[model samples]
Target: MVPTTITLHNTGNPLSPAANERGWLTNPANPRQASFHIVVDEREAIECIPLSENAWHAGDGSGSKSGNRTSIGVEICESGNYAKTLDNAVKLVAGMLKDRGWGVDRLRRHWDWSKKICPRLMYDDGKWTGWIDFKNRVNAELKGADNVKLDSEKVNVIVNGKKIKDGKLENGVTYVPLRAVGDALGATIGFDNKTKTATLDMKV
Candidate 1:
């Protein structure tokens, strides 16, 4: 049966984990399975399974093409599963949203369009349901991630105990090595193996 017209307004709050698992995975191949887009299991070190393909997770709702062509899905396996997977799932989904310029509104649960709670989870309330949450999370993560420092920024030059040349600058970063600069300045530059420093002999 073609699934479509799954409502989200004024829906049932939720059920216990045990009950959730039963209804969530009840049919395994159930049409509503795709509703929860992100399925996370926190038992191990954090596993993320994506449902970018069609999942028979959506029940007989309005848009139940099994999400093959339309929706993106994520399934995570975890232990102590009291929304533990929420953080990671949000990250993964945020990455997807950012990369594809999608909004949290695009981050839908199976029940949003069909008659099931495949993911059986939500972020706070509808406030974090769509692309807004996805974008915000991605920006936060991008800001916190380790930045790539350019090697060029560390290069400076000294000759005859005096600073004469500056390293070649690119993109506001420097890359000119001491030897290169000294040689350009008509100085015989050599590497001192013992001192581990570049020695420049200039015609003073």
Candidate 2:
């Protein structure tokens, strides 16, 4: 099924009775924890492990297909009661969504598809249950174009931070010209002397 929500859990122990410290156990043969594609250690500099197969972290009889099969399930091995882990979890999830071209709408908690109350922290309240807000946050960072505005004046040639040589801005400001700026930005600028045309390009 196409997932429409992303869930974050604090895998750390909690003092509250509602928040159980012990999590699910996996099979030794195919071990569930190893299936998680990326695991971030808040104590370190974002250590990550990429897995080709699914991790059985969800729950027993939960069927790997529902969550791990198509989900980039992440387990944060830090103190969940603190906000640092939660923030890091957000970053990790955002990066995954950007890499896979899946929006925040694709993020999901283990409990959403099964019997376990995975992503334990998120289950405390319904504040973060929805997808729209989370997706918006991810889209803003991934695209990096939402709030950024191109300076169309002052001979503006940069589009997405890359200087377009000799290319005129939409406002008709071809101030620095393409060849000069392109050459400065390490891009190749060409001049068609015969046709009186100039071309500046950079490989994406």
Report the lDDT tens digits of candidate 1 across residue range 1-204.
221211111113332232244355556666653343334333322212233434343454335344433554444443354344445555665566566655544545555555454334333233223223333444556455322345335445675566643555557755554444655677655444346555667768
- Runs in model 2 with CA error above 4 Å? 1-8, 14-35, 45-49, 60-64, 78-81, 126-136, 143-204
RMSD (Cα, Å) for all candidates, in order, is 20.2, 16.9
TM-scores of the models, in the order given: 0.37, 0.47
Which residue pairs come into collision in candidate 2?
5-107, 5-108, 6-107, 6-108, 32-56, 35-55, 165-178, 166-177, 166-178
Poorest 10 consecutive residues by lDDT, candidate 1:
2-11
State the TM-score for model 1. 0.37
How many residue pairs of model 2 clash at the backbone? 9
